[model samples]
Structures are given as C-alpha cells and as structure tokens.
Target: MSAPKVTVLDYGSGNVRSVVRALEHVGAEVTLSAKSQDVLNADGLVVPGVGAFAAVMKGLKDVDALRLIGRRVAGGRPVLGICVGLQILFDEGVEHGVRTAGMGEWPGKVERLQAEVVPHMGWNTVSPPEDSVLFNGIEDERFYFVHSYGVQHWDFDVSQPMMKPPQVTWSDHGGRFIAAVENGPLSATQFHPEKSGDAGAQLLRNWIGRLGKP
Candidate 1:
C-alpha cells in the first residue's frame, strides 16, 4: 500500500519541521502547507501548535486554518491535533488570566495545570481507555509533554448513544488531566508525539493505519 498522505498545517507556530520529519518516518507522505484548501483533500490533517492560546489562535485565523479544521471534522474526516493543537479544539482557553475562544469542536476549557511545577515537561506514562486505537500497541510506553496548560476534565455528554463517548487517556503531574482523546474521526494528544521517540512513532503508525481504513 502507498504511504498515507498527511498534511502538517503550518500556521506560523510550533516546530513544523520536526512534525514533518516524524510523520515521514512513520510511512506518511507529509506536506507542510499554509493553505487552508490543502487540508480538505488530505487523508489526514495534523494541527500542531506551540505558544500562548490567543497567539496561536491568531495564527490559525490569519491562515484560515480554523475553518478548514472545523469543516473537515464536520464531514467525518480524520484530523489530529498535537499539544496546543489539542487544547484549541475545546470551547476556550485561559492563559495568564486571558480567556480566548477556541474552535469549540469539543466542550471544556484549557487552563493552567495545578501542578506545583508548570510546563509539565518530559516523558510520562498515560492511562488509555479501553478500546483505544491511538494507544493500541503502545499503551505501556511514555510520551513527551511540555506545557503549563491543559483540559483538566472532559466535558462531553456520555448519555447520548448517537454521540459515542470519546476514548480518553489521562496522565498527571500534580493533578490528573487529559493526555489524549479519540473521538470518531477526530483525535488529539496533549503530548508531543514528534518528540516522544519510538513510542511516538508507533502512535503515528496507528493513526496512519486508521487513515487507510474505510
């Protein structure tokens, strides 16, 4: 089979090269595009970001990438978010006392981690939910994380059968927070898979495999 065509959205934030290299290493034909239209046709779209919430949102808005993500997701297309990429999928984010609206794909807000030490950097084990595709073969491994803010709790409705509950992975520093989430065609991770070494590679492979499925 041919490599999956993955687009690493470049909205002027985050380490786009590292993400491109990592995706290429995992059997993906990667393209780093700033154009919003590129994401629509990709087999999978990766939204990677680093820096403050409002700033990153501005970058996304500048390139109209936020609308692209929302449109693709609404069509049941596959989209993956990394770090702040994951955080912005929620309703809003609060950083340094500033509240900024997010893409609102999911309910909740990104807030500062309650940990004594901020920017929860380094490798940490994740507790993946049962039947998690993102952690299929690499559930026991650790992934790299570097951030001071995150979604402290999941806010999706679990009572509706039509809206299947997302598979959530949890990790902790001072208190538990969302590590990863798999919701239908939408998936995201609080950790940086591009910097997580071999374990991260396996996770990418899993996601790539999903891209090839019907």
Candidate 2:
C-alpha cells in the first residue's frame, strides 16, 4: 500500500517545514497546503502552530481553516493538532488579559501556565491514560515542549452519552497541564512532536498507522 497522504495546513503561523519533514520521516506522503479544500479531503490532516493564540486564530480564519477542521472532525475524520494548533481547538484563549474565541471543538480555555518560570522548554515525561493509541509504545519516553500557555484543565459533559471521554495525558511544570488528548478521530499534543527525537517519531508513526484503519 502507498503511504497515507497527509496534509499540514499552512496557515502562516507555525513551523510548516519542520512538521512536513517530520510527517514525511514517519512514512506519510505529506503536503503543505494553504487551501481549505485540501484539508477537507486529506486522509489525515495536521494543523501545526507556533506563537500566540490570537495570532494563530487570525491566520486560520483568513483561510477558513477553522471551518474546515470543524467540519472534517465533526464527520469523524482524523485530525492532529500541535502546540498552539491544539490550543485553538478549545472554546477560547485568554492571553494577556484578552480572550479570543477558539474553534470550540472541545470545552476549555487556553491560558498561561501558572509557573514561576514561563515557557516550559525542553524535554518532559507525560503520564498517558491506560488505553492511549498515540503513546502506544513510547509512553515512558520524554517529548519536547516549548510553550507558556496551555489548557490547564479539560471540560466535557458527562451527560452526553455519545461523547466518549477523551484519553488524556498530563505533564507537570510549575503545575500540571494537558500534554496530549485522544478523542475518537481527533488528537492533539501540547508538545512539539516534530522537535522530539525518536520517541516523537514513533508517536507520529502511531498516529499515521491509525489513518490506514477503517
């Protein structure tokens, strides 16, 4: 079988080349696309973002990426988000006293980590849930993180029977923040998997493998 065709949405906010290279290294036929339709039709989609929340949202909006992601995810397609890309999946983002609306795929807010030292840079280990597919064999390894803002908590309605609880991963700095989340067809990581070493490559491979199923 041919490698899964993956597209890294180019919304003018993230490390596009690095993400493309990482996905390619992990056995994906990756394309960097600025087109919304390409994102809608990809076998797997990656939204990678770096920098501020508001800025990234603006870039996504410019290309109608938020709608594309929401529509694709609602249809049960596989979508992976990285760093600020993951942050924008939440309801809103509070940065520097300003709150910007996110895509609202999940109920939560992205805020600055309440740590003495901002921008949690370098490697850190994450505690993944018992049945996480993304962390398959690399659960014990460390992943690279470089961000000050993160989703401090998860908010989901337990009353909704159809909504399965997400497989969550946690990591600590001054306090604990969401390291990764696997919710059905949607997955995200607060850390930079592309910057992470062998462990990160494995994580990407694991995600890619899922794209070939069903």
lDDT tens digits, residue span 68-114, model 1: 89888888889999999999999999987889999988899999999
Q: What C-alpha lDDT values do all the predictions have? A: 0.92, 0.92
1-214 in candidate 2: lDDT tens per residue? 8999999999897588999999999899998997867898889999998999999999999998888988888888899999998999899999999999998878899999999999899999999997899999998999999999998888788898976788889999999899998988899999999999999999999999999575
TM-scores, all candidates, are 0.97, 0.97
List CA RMSD, all candidates. Answer: 1.0, 1.0
Model 2: worst 10 consecutive residues (lDDT sum): 155-164
What clash pairs does model 1 have?
none
- Clashes (N, CA, C under 3 Å) per candidate: 0, 0
Q: Report the backbone clash tally of model 2.
A: 0
| Model 1 vs. true fold: TM | 0.97
How far residue 105's Cα lies from its native spot in candidate 1, in Å, is 1.1
